[model samples]
Target chain A: AQSVAQPEDQVNVAEGNPLTVKCTYSVSGNPYLFWYVQYPNRGLQFLLKYITGDNLVKGSYGFEAEFNKSQTSFHLKKPSALVSDSALYFCAVTSGAGSYQLTFGKGTKLSVIP
Target chain B: DTAVSQTPKYLVTQMGNDKSIKCEQNLGHDTMYWYKQDSKKFLKIMFSYNNKELIINETVPNRFSPKSPDKAHLNLHINSLELGDSAVYFCASSQTTGGSQPQHFGDGTRLSIL
Candidate 1:
């Protein structure tokens, strides 16, 4: 079975400061990781994904994630945070060999202070 | 235009009542999915259909059934709705069932049990 863990329930960062949301995964085969953001009363919007090739993957809204194969972790990062970036972030993972089912973490609430 | 859309954005009903949430995707994708987001912001996949065929079904109760009339539409029907069924349901679509293709999502339908 594949699973994802987001250790932090909430993360706070000041505006214009860098922010990171940690994510770790456990999967049998290769991991296909993804990050999504959800605003209030809205569905999750795809941020980025890490499949193969480069470890650093860039995504929408100036967000990026690094896939560390040695550590089995894929953490989302942003160079500079904005107040509008405050929302719920989710990390999901799926195995390359299994059915198309994504296992998601509980979610991390990001609060960007101005 | 909206790529993915769901009807009945907000649903409020008493226990034991039956309700249905409809979803449609205009992205010309072959795969569609239904997900439930609980109060704690935990997301879990309920069902997925590829080319109008059932592909993935989680451990959801029999009371919840999903039907795909065509490639673009996937509707969810719940019988004997309970308090535990109250959550935000999201519809999503992807180009295919496998690989690193990112899935697009609809706004979501918030269900409330009275």
Candidate 2:
């Protein structure tokens, strides 16, 4: 079984400041990590993913994430925070083989205060 | 065009009623999934289908059934709905079941059981 953890229930950041939403995962084998964002009354949008090779993966809307195997973490980051970027962020993990389900973490609500 | 879409964005019914939520993906993905976001905002997997075959059936109750008539479409049917079933049901699809293929999601159907 695969599982993910997002420790913070809510993250507050100032506009123009860098923001980070931390995530950690546990799986039997190499894990496939992902970050998704959900806007108000909207569906989840894929942000970034860490499959192989590059530890730092860039995704849509100027967002990026770093995959740290030693730490078992995949934290989403942005150089400049925008108020529009405030939303519910979720981290997910799935094993490389056998299982097809993606275990998602309890979402972290991001609030970019102006 | 919408990559993934689900119908009846809002569903309201009474206890012991039966309802269904329909989902369609135009991204030509091979795998589709059903998820539930409860009042606490925890996303949990309900079921998964790959190429019209049931693949991942989580610990969801038998009252919940999933049907994938085709690769592009997967639907969820709920029988004898309970107040606990009131939540947002989201449908998603991915290009493949393995790797870091990001799953695209729909706006979700908010089921309010009164």
Candidate 3:
């Protein structure tokens, strides 16, 4: 089964400063990685995904993630942080073959302070 | 327009009661999924349906059953609800069977068992 890990439980950053949420995955084959954000009392919204091709994948809300095959990491990154970006973030992965069900991380609570 | 929607945004019921959460997708995706988010904010896949057929059924309790009448809808029916069943239930849909495409999610149904 594919699995994802978010090492940090919370990440605090200042507004306008670049922020990052770390994510790693363990899968048998080429992994399909994804990043999602969840606001308070809401469902998780899809942010971006990495299937193949470019290592740097840009997504919604001016967020991007880099897929590192050697490091086995898919970290979410934003050049500038905003208070609105403060929310729970999750990393997910699915194996290349077999079940397409995504395995998600525990989630990281991001707090962007002004 | 909302791509995915779920009925009863909030559900409050006593233990031993039964409840059902309805989900529908307007994106015309062939695959639909049910996910459970615990208090700790851990998201896990509960079930998945492809073309109205049960495709992925996780280790969810037998009391929880999913029904898919068509490709556009997948509803979750929980029997004899327990306190442990209290959590946020989310419905999502994707265009492809594989994990290449990012899944779109609904707001979610927050079930509170008392």
Candidate 4:
């Protein structure tokens, strides 16, 4: 079975400061990781994904994630945070070989303070 | 033009009532999925259909049934709705099951049981 763990229930960062949301995964085969953001009362919006190739993957709205194969982790990062970036962030993983079902984390609530 | 859309944005009903949530996608994708988001912001996949055929069913209760009329539509029907069934239901579509294809999501239908 594949699973994802987002250790932090909430992450706080000041405006214009860098922010990171940690995520780790456990899967049998190669992992296909993804990040998604959800605003209040809105559906999840895809941010980025890490399949193969480069470890650093850039995504929408100036967000990026680094896939650390050695650590089995994929953390979402933003160079500078904005107040509008406050939302719920979810990290998901799926097996590349079988069972394309996405397993999502508990979600990290990001609060960007101005 | 919404890529993915769900009807009945807010549903409020009493226990034992039956309700249905409808979803449609115009992205010309071959795969569609239904997900449930709990109050704690935990997401779990309920069902997935590829080319109008059932592909993934994630141990959901028999009270919840999903029907795909065509490639563009997938509807969920719940019988004997209970208080525990209240949650935000999301509809998503992807170009395909595997690979790097990102899933597009609808705004979601918030179900409230009283």
Q: Tell me model 4's lDDT, rounded to 2 decimals.
A: 0.95
Candidate 3 chain B weakest lDDT stretch, 10 residues: B96-105
lDDT (10s digit) by residue, model 2, range A1-114: 678989999999999999999999999889988899999899999998888899999999999999999999999999999999999999999887555688899999999999
Query: Which residue pairs collide, candidate 2?
Result: none
Q: What's the count of clashing pairs in each model shown?
A: 0, 0, 0, 0
Residue B56 C-alpha lDDT in model 4: 91
Q: Which stretches of candidate 2 lie over 4 Å from their true place?
A: none
| Model 1 TM-score on chain A | 0.98
Q: Write the per-residue lDDT of candidate 3 for residues B1-114, one digit (tens) a residue.
A: 988999999999999998999999999899999999888988888999999999888899999999999999999999999999999999999997777878899999999999
lDDT of residue A10 for candidate 2: 99
DockQ of each: 0.71, 0.75, 0.73, 0.71
Steric clash pairs (candidate 3): none
Error of 3 at B44 (Å): 0.8
lDDT of each: 0.95, 0.93, 0.93, 0.95
lDDT (Cα, tens digit) per residue for candidate 3, span A25-71: 99988998999999998778999999889999999999999999999
Native-referenced DockQ of model 1: 0.71
| Higher-scoring candidate on DockQ, 1 or 2 | 2
Candidate scoring better on lDDT of 1 and 3: 1
Model 3 sits at a Cα RMSD from the real structure of 1.0
List, residue by residue over A23-113, the lDDT tens digit for candidate 1. 9999988999999999999999999999899999999999999999999999999999999999999999999744588889999999999
